[model samples]
Target: MLPFSGNASPLPRNAGVALILALAAIVTASGLLLWLQARALHRGTSAYAALETEHLRVAAAETARAALYVLAADPDLSVDHPGEDWAQPLERDWPGGIHAWARVEDAAAYVDLNNLACSNQPGRPFSAILRNAFTACGHFEADAPVDALADYVDADTTGDYEAAFYRHADAPLLPPDRELWAPAELLHVHGFSPALFAPPAPAPDARHHRDELFGGDFRQATVLLPDAPDAPVPVNLNTATREALLAVAGIEHAATVRSAMSLRALHPFQSTTLLAAASPDLASTLEGAIDVKSAYYRVRATAEHDGRRRSILAYARRDPDGTVHLLQWLEGVS
Candidate 1:
């Protein structure tokens, strides 16, 4: 016989086990809900961070462009290009509580791609410089190939310069190289070497400061030789090589001419001497045929964004009074 209690009952072992299982299930469900909520929050936070970084990058680019506009518009600014001592952060002004600064790079501060001093032949003296420019830009050529660009653009050429560009095996329908608007494109050319293109390393007692070098674009080795109005340097018809004469602006030849020796015999011509001494027929042919001056000049600008920094490349021309005009801009450089 067992005594029965009024307020108590004997529980089955199975019923007690059932109660414990129910409690365990609730605890696991609660934990899973919390984990899911935390994951959602982390994803939202990551997305917001990415969006903020992009906005900051765009702001940085705009800041650079605005500073460039200021440099171009200021009348009091000096005519000196970026490489000169005058180009500095003080040249620009920032607005709207935005912290901004800039560095002007002289395009001429580096080796000029247009300089035709390749084998030292007047016709092709710029080969080495071109090669160097290409080397500095290793990826450009393998991706986009242009074989004989310099030869095609100069004053005299036998045919269309673009014909020489080779097409990639992947896309033979398209030309390997594209048209170039700036000397920086040299880095995009094929067979260029980095060792040759990089500026000579800084010397222990370097007269030029690092700021000066970083602030400019690379320049071409060849500059327009001064020429008189009527007699400009006669790009030799018989002696000039095809590469040297191709980009001469106005010279037209029927076929590739070998003029290495002939060009050496001919002295550098100013318009005054060249026009008078050249055959009348030849002189008449080249009246507006040559560009006695070079159109390219280097430019640079810098800006700060999100506590980070960036640089830009610009090619430009300036009037005698320090007013600058844009030729090109390298955007979003870090």
Candidate 2:
């Protein structure tokens, strides 16, 4: 069987096959190593991106705090109006095309939901005032939800729904039976809905009748929660919109609110006593609901860098001693 004479042997062919297998193994191992290296690099880049975004967010938040401190130190903290330096928007440009900005607003301009209840019980005078405001703004059926909210916060079971109503739901829930720490907590209540709480969108027609009724889409109305549970929530005469003033004073006091607004434009009230003197009728009606100075403010800050964006929302308090303190901080999605 020794073909092509005795010179050819089978061992030579076996050796050649072994060489090809070794080469194939080497190629496969190289490809695997390359893939692993690429995956590691991708993970490192992602981590770095996240770190940079966090830095931007922190920088923006600090900028907001600094501005608030300056505002607190100002000589005249009696009034917070649209034309004030603190109310104006702030922006700054940084290295690597990064930019940061912040905006401050007086929290007293909005209605405090906690003020709706008196000593953990509902049906207080403030509740009726809010209902009247909602009705005047064309949301006539606001009683059920508002009452439900009051029941959810009060320390008793006197709301429109009982504990069984929530317990028997698809997902059982329980009320906190305490003051709400944030306005967004309303979403957890039985009757509260996002549509009712969210800011209204612009109407289809620019000149619509509902515009007048709803105070130009109700941009002036908002809900706020103070850091102090027992502190009185008073609407700031200098910062509150006419709609808010009317809401706190009731629809019947529309003429008085208009007059007060006009008077404040010419000369902002330096004290609550001055506001009372300016509108004796409104002063009598909204004795406990109105004020001339603001103790709380909301700050919104945003930062952008290398096509990435970060945002922060904060609730702050300016003490009577002219010190600013942060009550709550919220970090938003990019």
Candidate 3:
């Protein structure tokens, strides 16, 4: 085994070990460099996402303001219908490839929920409208949500669907006992579910369409006029759907509603007198509850860039003089 004679062997045994160590060091350094590059890329993406959110927010806000201005520019505020210019949706293409869209809907086209809160009595005229809506939709015990919402909105604790009913669930809950901050808060009340508020699926037939009018499209048939519990928003005769019109008045004579719809389709009703001439009985029933114009409008605005999007829901009041005042602004609406 001592074939090597001099102090130096053919080669040092440590040389092989040194080579392995050098290769390992190089590999480790390469791995570290790759990791740093990946981390930098991740940070960059995050930063870009944040910036995009800000840009979208600004664009969405701009869209909302532009929509309100469009509403303000309407030449005639005496009457508003879907055919009006302001009722048309607005869209714009910004310089930076960002796109925005906005639209306004007659808020009075639906039953106003805050009106129920204002009365807190289910059988009153306004509450009856909500009840009739549920009935039209074929909801059993049509008064259930009406009463439940009463408990949720009233300050007093003396209601059948009040706070106590929510306490025994797997997760106990308590109502705020105040006006709702938003329509979505209805989910927190007893006897209300997410399914109830979801958009109605399209129906293929006439019979199914009638049933979906209020029952399945409950969310579309009702609204919560922001911070307006005491002042009632009248149903716009020029814009209210047949279901909504029947809710305010009664469907005992659906023929009456059909006649009104038929007449309005031919030409928009200019005043309550026109409705009175059509049917004195219907006019009487809808007296203070109806208007040829809408004061409240719901505005939705959205912006998108690079497949990312942002949105806002705006509630506003339009005065007869074409003035627009924003009542509420909700961000993060899809």
Please provide TM-scores, in order, for all candidate models, with all chains considered together: 0.43, 0.84, 0.85
Q: Which stretches of candidate 1 lie over 4 Å from their true place?
A: 1-28, 74-86, 90-98, 108-178, 181-190, 193-333
Per-residue alpha-carbon lDDT of candidate 2 for residues 202-302, written as tens digits (9 for 90 to 100):
56786653454454224356555656455457778888876678787777766767777887888777777765665666666666677788888888888
Task: Output the TM-score of candidate 1.
Answer: 0.43
lDDT value, candidate 2, whole model? 0.71
Candidate 3 lDDT, 123-161, residue by residue in tens = 236767777777666565767778888778777888888
Model 2 Cα RMSD, 1 decimal: 3.9
Instruction: Return whichever of 1 and 2 wins on TM-score.
Output: 2
lDDT of 1 at 19: 75
Report the Cα lDDT for candidate 3. 0.78
- Candidate 3 lowest-lDDT run of ten: 207-216
lDDT of 1 by residue, 38-94 (tens): 999999988976665555445555655555555555543322233233345533434
> RMSD of each candidate?
12.7, 3.9, 3.7
